[model samples]
Target: MSFTFFTPGPAQLYPTFEKHLQTFVSEQLGSISHRSQQYRDLHKFTVDQLRTLLNVPDSHAILFLGSASEAWERILFSCVELESFHLVNGSFSKKFYDCSNALNKYAHLFEKPMGESFVASEIVVPEYAELICTTHNETSSGVQMPVAEIHKLKQRNPGKFIAVDMVSSAPYPELDYSLIDTAFFSVQKAFGLPAGLGVWIVSEKCLQKAESIRNQYSIGAHNDLPTLWKNALNNETPATPNVMGIYLLGKIAEDFNKIGVQTLRKETEHKASLIYKFIEKQPGFSTFVKEKANRSQTVVVTNTEMPSADIIKHIKAKGMVVGSGYGKYKATQLRIANFPATSVEDVEKLIHELGSL
Candidate 1:
């Protein structure tokens, strides 16, 4: 039996996803070569739709990659030569810092407890650090770093390149692209598409940085920033990409555009408010992120008084699926995705089921 999915990434598919996928398969769009004009047109359409939906500036180039995880490595490799700084609050943010360390860069972090948020005024970037990384929404902890805080951070450190990991909160954070040097998100999350495609948004300055340091280090060969940017100008990729995923993303974005992003954002907030308000009154359950201001609107995480597995099992039996906690909190938390694909009705049903328990 098919069940409604509220799992964060790989969550419920968009409402019209099946219809679009059927059209894609029947047309054999996937058979087109990446270099073919057909594929280029598709590529340009997806990038343009995303740019319009997300308000990405012309100065920022949109490049498709393997996944958001890959984008992390690309950002570190292409932008930072020696030093980088990160704000670490949860698993995803910590992993970005780990990527920097694995790349042998001098990565420094201002870390906090899992559910805590960062304040821009308190953050101090090292003088020699060339890049600053922040996760717009911490999926694991359901904590979000406010866009204003990110802008403030940029204001304070005018010279540092700011890279945002919007993996689970894309198309939701109304980020002023000018304030950030780079940002990325995978389609599997907010876009409600199957996993595999990652969209990386990089500023002109970041591309120039890659060019400046190309001769100094092994910044990557094929999927490097310079290479990706060069091909993106022609609406193409350096290697074969997930053509099906790209097409579906464009169609879904077009759907989002028709509905208006502001309307979607407002609806997302309405659904999130229902979930958060339910958590407030639900006995034996509490929000993972204590501060209301820092909670994620896209992924709502809650601490359960009972074993989360039992709660998950109980909910699953009723034909809806939610995510268990990430990492160590696996048995004690519930992660409910409040993505654009999940409607107010879906959330209401999930809440009704939770209320019954």
Candidate 2:
């Protein structure tokens, strides 16, 4: 049976996804050679659509990678020579920090309990840290660090390159590109696309840093920043990329642009409010994150009184699906994605099912 997915990451498909996919297949878009002029046009179209949809600056170059996880390793390897700092509040943020450590970079972290958020004023960035990593929205814990707070960190540490992992909150964070040196997100989350493509947006300054330190560290070979940047200048990639994913992303982004990003954001906020309000009154549930201001508008996590498995099964039977909690909270919590692909009507229906539970 077909079900509307409320799961984070590979959540519900964009409303126009099927139509676009059918057209792409019929047109044989996937068979195009990556090095051909046809492919470069496709590449540029996607990047242009994304820049328009997300308000990305012209100074930033958007490059495609395997996944947001890979971008974590690339950013550390290419940009940092000695030290990096991270604000960790959940699994994903912690994983970015872990990636840095795995890469042999001296990774420093200011960690908070899973459901807590960070305050910019309280963060003490190490002077030796070359790049500062922040997760705009923690998908694992349903906590969001305000974009303003991120801007404050950048302002306070003008010398440090700021990287934001907007993995699950892309096109939603409304970040000021001038403030951040780099940011990334995977297509599966907010873009509502099939998983596989990771979008890394890097500033010219970040590119310069990677070039200066390229010989100093083993910053990879084929997919290194310099290599990626060189090809991206021509609207291409060093290696063959997910052409189908890029096509769908461009089409969907074009759809989003036509609908207007502001309209989508307002709809997302409305839907999030619906779910949070329902959780507030539901007998067997409470929001995982306590502070409303810090709660994520994209991924809403709730502490369930009953096993999350039971709750998930209950909802699945009603023709809908939601995500189980991450890691340790697997059995005790539920995550509901309020991405643009999931409609307000769908959210209302999901709430109705939860209310019935």
Candidate 3:
């Protein structure tokens, strides 16, 4: 039987995916060389669409890389010369901190328990730390950092750079680009394309940081920030580009643009509310996030009193696929993605099925 995917990131295909694929083959997008004008046009179109749709400023340079995971290394190697600070809460945030350590950078952390968040006023940044990394939404725990709090941290630490992992929450938070120096996400998450492409948006300050360190150490061969900045000036990449992915991203973004980001965000909230409300009223289930304010609109995770396998089994029997909890919580929690690609009708159906159980 066929299944509807509610698994987060690599979750649901954007409703137009099959159509995008047909266009990819019919237009021979895969046959075009990266250096060709056809490929260049595709690159420029995708960049322009993302910038306009996401409200990115002219001061930011948009670059495409492998995955959001790779962007973590790029941010550390390119932007941080010595020390960095992290606000860790869940698996993804902890990974970002681990990435800093893996690179031999002096990484300091102000960690909260799995479901808690950083208090902006209480945050203390180390004097010599060059970058402060934050996860806008932790997909593993379904907890989100408020954008206003991020702005507050920037206000408090004007001299240091703020890097955000918006992996599963981008194009929805309506971030004020002026407040963040760097942000990154992979298409397989919110954008709903097949995996293998990441989008990194960096501001002028971040570019300067990379340029200053370029002469000293090799950040990355094909994806060094300075090289990426230089190529993005012409809407290109240093490596052979993911032409089809870029083309598909452009087409899917165009559809999102036509519908408007505000509308999609509202729809996401509406759909997420249905599930949260269900959990509140249902027995043997509660949100992984203790505070309602900490809940993520894009990825909703619930703690089941019993093993989540029965829920998964019941949902799967109805031809809908749901994700198990991340890492150690695998047997106890369920993760449901509420992305632009997941329809409100589908969410309601899933809620009804979940309620029936």
Worst 10 residues of 1 by lDDT: 213-222
Q: What is the TM-score of each candidate against the true structure?
A: 0.99, 0.99, 0.98
What lDDT does each candidate get? 0.93, 0.92, 0.90
| Winner by lDDT | 1
State candidate 2's TM-score.
Answer: 0.99
**Superposition error at 53 for model 2 (Å):** 1.0
Instruction: Give lDDT for model 2.
Output: 0.92
Query: How far is 68's C-alpha from truth in model 2 (Å)?
Result: 0.9
lDDT of residue 158 for candidate 1: 88
Error of 2 at 290 (Å): 0.7
Q: Considering only N, C-alpha and C atoms within 3 Å, which residue pairs clash in candidate 3?
A: none
Clashes of 1: 0
lDDT of 1 by residue, 159-194 (tens): 999999999998999999888889999999989999
What tens digits encode model 2's per-residue C-alpha lDDT throughout 62-178? 999988899999999877999999999999999999999898899999999999998789999998999999999999999999999999999999899999999999888899988
